[model samples]
Target: MARYILDHSTRPDPLLAELAAETAAATGESAEMQISADQGTFLTMVTQLVAPRVAVEVGTFTGYSSVCIARGLSGGTLHCFDVSEEWTSIARRYWHKAGLADRVTLTLGPAQDTLSAFDQPIDLAFLDADKPGYPAYYELLVGKLRPGGLLMVDNTLWTGHVADPDRHDASTVRMREFNDLVAEDPRVTVVILPLADGLTMIRKNPDLS
Candidate 1:
């Protein structure tokens, strides 16, 4: 099924393909942290649909996803937060190569600290950061999202461990809790798509008080 989906879905552009290859070669096992090609396409589609003037990405590892988001933006700005200079530095080169450097701003710091200082309303927010930080990031992102804005979260399934009764790891437990919290939240309508790990889409209610 996954192979069929990939085969049928749109492929990444040459630049993006190169970026993915470089990321894999550079990071080896850790390259698994990068978003899959299908997920990247999904992100671009969502960004194009939202046409956000301002989008925020909580995790910007190596910039593959950031490139997709930026490409979809119609003159919008993307704020990317990541703590590792070593990882994001690689992203910077690709951003430049993709001609997305102007649209993206990379912040090297704890996303928790940087996100707290964000005061402007956001049209779109993508959360691909630490599993344990999802709750806090969701709180901050939801509060900042304009009514009718979209929030997309990656890896909610945690490779299927989220539903497994025997797996009680900290990440799995936190992801389960986060999924429940979003499910019950009144501010947004949620849907969890089984794309790549698991992508959760939340749209803020337009009828805001």
Candidate 2:
């Protein structure tokens, strides 16, 4: 079923496919951190739908997701925050190759620190960084997002461990807490889709305080 879903979904571009392959070959086991092709397609679709002028991504593994988001932007800019220069260097190559270098900016540092420097409104935000930092990132991103803007969070389900009380690992616990917080927040209407690990989409209410 998963294979069929992918087969029916939008096919990745040649550059995206090449980037995914290079990332898998280079990163070995860690390549799983990269978003799946279907998720990439979803990101691009949402980005195009929102047509955000300013977007932010918290995690950029090898640039696959970044490429999707940047490609969908209609002459907007994307600010990517990640702590690894090594991984982002690979992403930079693909961004350059895809002619998105001008539309995207990469910042190497703790996302919390770098994200603090931005006071401008954000039209869209994607969070796929450390699980423990989700709460902090959420607080920051939600405040920065303009009313009616979208915030997409990845890995909220944590491989279904979030619903398993027996699984009390740190990541699982953190995700569970974050999920509950988002669900209860009056600022946004939220829905969690069982895509990949789990993708939670939140749209800030127009009357958000």
Candidate 3:
């Protein structure tokens, strides 16, 4: 079923394919951190629809997701924040190769510090960073997200353990807490899609913005 879903979805282009291949060969086990092709396609579609002037991505691993988002921009910039210079260097190369260097910006540092300093009203944001930092990132992103802005969070399902009553592992527990936090927040509407682990979409209410 998963394979069928992917087969039907829009495929990644050559540049994206090369990025995936290089990520796996170079990063080895860490390549699992990169978003899947379907997710990348989804990001592109959402960005196109939103047509945001300022988009933000937290936890850009190897830049697959960023590339997807940047490709969808008409006149917007995608701001990527990550702690690893090594991983993002590869991403930077791909961005340049895809001719999207002008539409994307990279910031290397702790997202807590870098994101707090970002003053632009975010029209869209993607969070796939450390699980423990979700709450902090959520606060900062939601605070800066303009009214009706969209925020997408990845890997919130933790292999579906978040819904399992018997799963007591630390990561599973932590993910559950984060899910609950988003669900309970009154400022945004939340929906968790069971695509690629779990993708949660949060849209800030325009009235409250």
Candidate 4:
């Protein structure tokens, strides 16, 4: 249903081609991880709009989205969570080259643990981690987000698997559940935009009770 709508409306941005090339070249190696350029642009646009002072990002895959978010943040702090040192090392070089290393902090560990340790209210949060953990991450992050804070979840469409009842993989199942959960929740307003695999945007309201 949603996939059909998005499929017809979807159009690729030109910026992604350049970023994809740069990200691939920077790694100098092929891997199973990489984000679409359209997604990267979405992150950057969101960051630029909110101009958050403190941001939390779960799943910094090769730092493409991280770099995009960080670039939009002038003097703000961006906390990135990832368990892979090898993957992040590749990200670091690009961060440094992009002159955004100083504003970004990489936490090497399970994202849940890293997120739990934070005591301050997050101005903005990005969740792109394991599909099964979306519920848990949402619980914790929503509690931590300040009023009007933004929460962005990537890969919500699961490559059009969520709507297909026949394709019930664990990841797809979890994503479907998460999507339904968010839609029903009254604490925030959500917009599931069909851009580069689908991004679910949630804006928290302080008065929701």
Choose the strongest candidate by lDDT. 3
* Model 2 lDDT tens row, 119-149: 7799999999888899999999999999999
Task: At residue 102, give the lDDT of candidate 4.
Answer: 97
lDDT per residue for candidate 1 within 1-209, as digits (tens), equals 99999999999989989989999999999899999999999999989999999999999989999999999999899999899999899999998998889999988898888999988899999999877788998999999999999999999988999999999987888889999999999999999999999999999999845
lDDT of 4 by residue, 1-209 (tens): 74564455433444444546765775666533466655666678789989999999998877778888997796799999988897788678778878898999999998788889988789999988877888999999999999999999988988999999899788788889999999998899999987767889999977855
- 2 versus 4: better TM-score goes to: 2
| Cα lDDT computed for each candidate against the true fold | 0.93, 0.93, 0.95, 0.82
Q: Per-prediction TM-score, please?
A: 0.97, 0.96, 0.98, 0.85
Q: Between 1 and 4, whose TM-score is larger?
A: 1
Write down the worst ten-residue block by lDDT for model 4: 9-18
Ranking by TM-score: 3, 1, 2, 4
Clashes of 4: 0
Once model 1 is optimally superposed onto the true structure by TM-score, how far is the C-alpha of residue 29 displaced, in angstroms? 1.2
> Candidate 2, after superposition: displacement of residue 105 in Å?
0.9
- Please state every model's RMSD to the true fold in angstroms: 1.0, 1.2, 1.0, 4.1
Q: Rank the candidates by lDDT, best first.
A: 3, 2, 1, 4
